[model samples]
Target: MSIVERMKNLSEKECPVDILRKEIAGSKCSDCGKCVFGYEGVTQLQMMLGDITEKKGKGTDLALMKELCALMKTQSLCEDGEDVADAVSYALAHHAQEFEAHVAKKGCAAGVCKKFMTYHILAENCTGCGDCLDACEEDAIAGKKRFIHVIDQKECIQCGACMDACDEDAIVRAGAVKPRCPKKPVPCKRK
Candidate 1:
């Protein structure tokens, strides 16, 4: 077959892969406020069960999906069902492994990976600048009236989005090497 034919065949045979990244790849539930509410929202479990059942027919198993969905419900959601279904899809496809690897509340209160959330600046050391906010992928930084910065622990995803953007050497990872995850699904780090 011609190369074009091969490519077309590949696309056709490909399993249903998400084209738009509304959620992380392996973990659909990233503990983001959106998912805490959206996927399992303030609805009856019966309704959630029905939706999961219909969605499962596509490939996911409904009962199994609900079990996982129940788990996500504990976190609180962003209150839009379809808004965050992709995260549920990711969790369905990849399971809890991604959750363990990426979404722990202890170190990553901001939902970003340790690898990404390496650096932080002591506020007293800050030089009242806005550069860090520009670099942060998580948008964790909130500059105060004096241009002092504070990291919003909840919204952070340690993608090193800020360190590269700082000029005053305010953000540093505290010299700890976050254990590298090898090919662990990037399934949404944080924020």
Candidate 2:
């Protein structure tokens, strides 16, 4: 039930004859004794699909890739048709986890996804800034009079509201901040 084997079987029994002929013209025909309908290599098929997608204006969309991967996870098909979809589905579903462990190795599940931000309280720097206290949706920041501003990591969402509220530049990001969906790092682990 490997995709390669299943693809050949499907191609032989269900694929269009014209498609098979085109594959042959591409000199990608499989001469396997058992192959009834020639099948181009899987990599070629991937490339061809890319070309077709571009022509159709369905260019690579990461969200689409994720949907396809997730669908494939529960999909019944085991061949190329099925595998490609599954790959996309899974990638989209867990793109965040995959991204975090990537070059950044950070997680923003608590709304604290960036490294440039962290939970902290400015002692002398803070003039008992109530702006942050008023901005805090979680009441994590607590102080009165001259008490320093403190951040409760256990509750702070890392929304950077405190950072924006702090006129004294007391708030900061914990580590390297990145987009919610990064495209520069590349998805595959090659780079």
Model 1 TM-score is 0.31
Off by over 4 Å in 2: 1-117, 176-191
lDDT of 1: 0.42
Candidate 2, residues 103-132, lDDT tens digits: the string is 232332333223324656535356664688
**Largest TM-score belongs to which candidate?**
2
lDDT of 1 by residue, 1-191 (tens): 32112222323222221211212222233333354454334233324323322222222333454455455445544323432343444443543332232322223222223342345665545665667877776667776434556666567765676777776675666322432221211222221
Q: What's the TM-score of each model vs. the native?
A: 0.31, 0.37
User: How accurate locally, in lDDT, is each candidate?
Assistant: 0.42, 0.42
Output the lDDT of residue 134, model 1: 74
